[model samples]
Target: MLDIMAIISDGIGGGLKSVLNIAIIVFPLMIIMEIAKDLNILDKISDFCKPLTKWMGVSKESAFPLTIGLVFGLAYGAGIIIQSAKEGNLDKRSLILVSIFLVCCHAVIEDTLIFVAVGANGFFLLTIRLLTALVLTILISKKLPSLDKEK
Candidate 1:
């Protein structure tokens, strides 16, 4: 069975390059994120984001994790959230809601660079992505249903 699987995989020749590229790109990014965490840069960024998060009905403590999620990807951001959750800083409902929003994902530099490299109106894509994130956040908060049931 394994031999058959390998043979099938071999049929997709050019597709194999994408797998290698994905691994190369992701591993370095993960390492960089770890370094940023160790350096307390993430903490500083979270502190900066607190006020905005507070205004949006999330705890100030949520700022950093959400920032990580936005600047990295859903996995990295959720790693932060999971830590916070383990420490009892975030409740179940808030984490769940935040995950929904954060899964939309962002990359601080790479995404824009890709657009510029490809000549796809980089600024336009960036503007739309940013606005969409902000608008969706506000809209979701407004549309949020009460998770708590009154006795």
Candidate 2:
């Protein structure tokens, strides 16, 4: 009985710790994103990413969220993506493309470092992920019917 109670307690404690850690990271990122939006930093980022987004057939508004997802992982990026969608910055097609791309390649730096620590080839891993994401997003974007046409 005592052992079971300890196990339950440990599980709950670990879950709370994980949640707290994520909250710590996500909250600050959300605030910084808001400040960046107010400063028009997002516009510059979108402009810089214009070529890539254009190639992906997504709106420029997707650039920031896609960049965030690739660098910081999806959990952190989802906040920005959701906010952009709510603001009407991303249409359905853009959202779908960004989600597809990030699903394949999110957290490139962190994941690559972790794999490298485990004796994996970091360059190969990063390259394959990036290439797969890019190709897949481009192909899927071409297939998807434009939401604008439905409206």
Candidate 3:
């Protein structure tokens, strides 16, 4: 009984520790993102992404969250994506394109750095991921119906 109690306690402690670690990362990221948004830095990033997004056949609305997800990771980008969708900023086709792109290649910088720490070639990995995401997003975006057609 004592052993069982200790095991249960350890499990609970581990779970709480994991949650705390996640909150530590996520909260700071969110705060920084909020500040960037307010400072219009996010708009600049979105503007920089416009040509890439145009090549992918998505709108400028999708570019902002897509750029954020590409740089910061899904947890950071998801909030903006949800807000944009709720506000009807992105059309269905653009949302679909952005979702697929993010799924394939979100967290570019962090994930590449992590893999590099484990002896992977960060440049090669980043290139492959970016290329795969771009090609797939472009192809899928072409296959999907246009927003105007939906309405």
- Candidate that scores best on TM-score: 3
lDDT of 3 by residue, 1-151 (tens): 8999999999999889766765665667668767886898967887888998889988777888988898778976788788898999987788878988899999886677656655689889999999999999898887887877867
Against the true structure, candidate 2 reaches a TM-score of 0.69
lDDT of each: 0.71, 0.82, 0.82
lDDT of candidate 2 at residue 4, scale 0 to 100: 100
Candidate 2 C-alpha lDDT tens digits along 53-134: 8989998778889877876689977888899989989899999899989988887766776566546898899999988899
- lDDT, residue 101, model 1: 65
- Which of the two candidates, 2 or 3, achieves a greater TM-score against the reference? 3
43: Cα error in model 1, Å: 2.3
Rate residue 68 of model 3 by lDDT. 88
On the 0 to 100 scale, the lDDT of residue 146 in model 1 is 52
TM-score of 1: 0.65
By TM-score, highest first, what's the ranking?
A: 3, 2, 1
lDDT of 3: 0.82
- Kindly list the per-residue Cα lDDT of model 1 for residues 96-119, writing each as its tens digit: 667766765467446655556445
Over 4 Å off, model 2: 1-48
Q: How close to the true structure is residue 128 of candidate 1, measured as C-alpha lDDT?
A: 80
TM agreement with the true structure for every prediction: 0.65, 0.69, 0.71
Show where candidate 3 strays beyond 4 Å.
1-41
